[model samples]
Target: MKRTIPLAIVLTMGITMMVQFFVPHPVSVGYYDLTTRWIRIVGAFALVLGTGSFIMFHSDKVRRRRQGWYYSIISLVALVVTTVIGLGWGIRPGSILQNVIYANFLVPLNASMFAILAFYMASAAYRAFRARTKEAALLLIAAFIVMLGMVPIGASIWGKLPELAEWVLSVPNMAAKRAIIFGVALGGIATSLKVILGIERGWLGGGKQ
Candidate 1:
């Protein structure tokens, strides 16, 4: 009964949401709005549940004095401090949470993370641009044209290089992008159907159907 009730709810909600896309009736719109509000309420409860799980998991690690337990302690401290600041001070524009914590701490941390990611991206690009095969050679040439076209030096070397790059981007790149999007859309539809029909039981615990 436990699994059956949840599965039924999921099936009903999934089919209703999908059908609502094709439905233009006032009733359908009302239902959509009602469900969305309920979703937000559920989301608040989920957030609380998630926080509890996080604290418990980290606390266990810290209690065991496991490897890198200091990191877990730091995480727990950060969570508590951030939560208290946000709740107590209010996250208004001039509040300490916004001005000090967000602007001074979070913003710089995010920027640093992104800066590190840029190096990884450059490394990946270098490996991808290596021309060993015919496909790789073509990709390298296209990438070269695109990169050079964005610069003034390319126009000085060849005036038509920018136009050629634009063609490669608009025509071949866009076509491939659309094809990939279509494939993704189809895959999502298939997955949704599997879940709705109870064919996908992975979401159920213990790998049981």
Candidate 2:
């Protein structure tokens, strides 16, 4: 009984949503709009649940004198400050204090996070690149080619290197990204259907029907 209820909702909503794509009627369009709204509501509720969980976890860490209590304090302070500022004064980029927050806090923090990726990439290259075996040697060669191809030095030395880099990035890279994106889009539609029909009860946590 427990499984059957959710399964039935999933089947009903999934079929209706798929059919709505073909149907061109007022009723079908209405159903689609209603389902979309329900999905949005569920998403908002999920955010609330997530925020509550985050606060509870951090509060417990702070209470227990955890090693990362300082980070917890910082996170809570940032959240409260941001919320109060946004609510009290409009969150406009033109606002001096908001601009200060963005300049001093958000821009520096996010930019630094991304800047660390270069160091991480260097470390990874050091560890991974070894001309040990046939496949490893081929990979090392390809990595070196791609890395150097992006720089003016290699492209200047070998004129075709930049062309090869462009082909790899535009063709194979785009194809792989498109495949992943298609799969993600399908998954999102399926999940939205399940949520609207209340089939994904785990989002609400298990409880008595």
Best prediction by TM-score: 1
The sequence of per-residue lDDT tens digits that candidate 1 reaches over residues 42-120 is: 9889787788899999999999999999999999999989989999999778998999999999999989988898888
Indicate the worst ten consecutive residues by lDDT in candidate 1: 200-209
lDDT (tens digit, per residue) of candidate 2 on 10-49: 7788779889999989999999999999999888888887
Against the hidden reference, what TM-scores do the models get?
0.89, 0.74
State residue 61's C-alpha deviation in candidate 2, in Å.
1.4
- The collision pairs in model 1 are none
> Which stretches in model 2 have alpha-carbon errors above 4 Å?
1-7, 169-209
Q: Give me the displacement of residue 91 in model 2, in angstroms.
A: 1.6
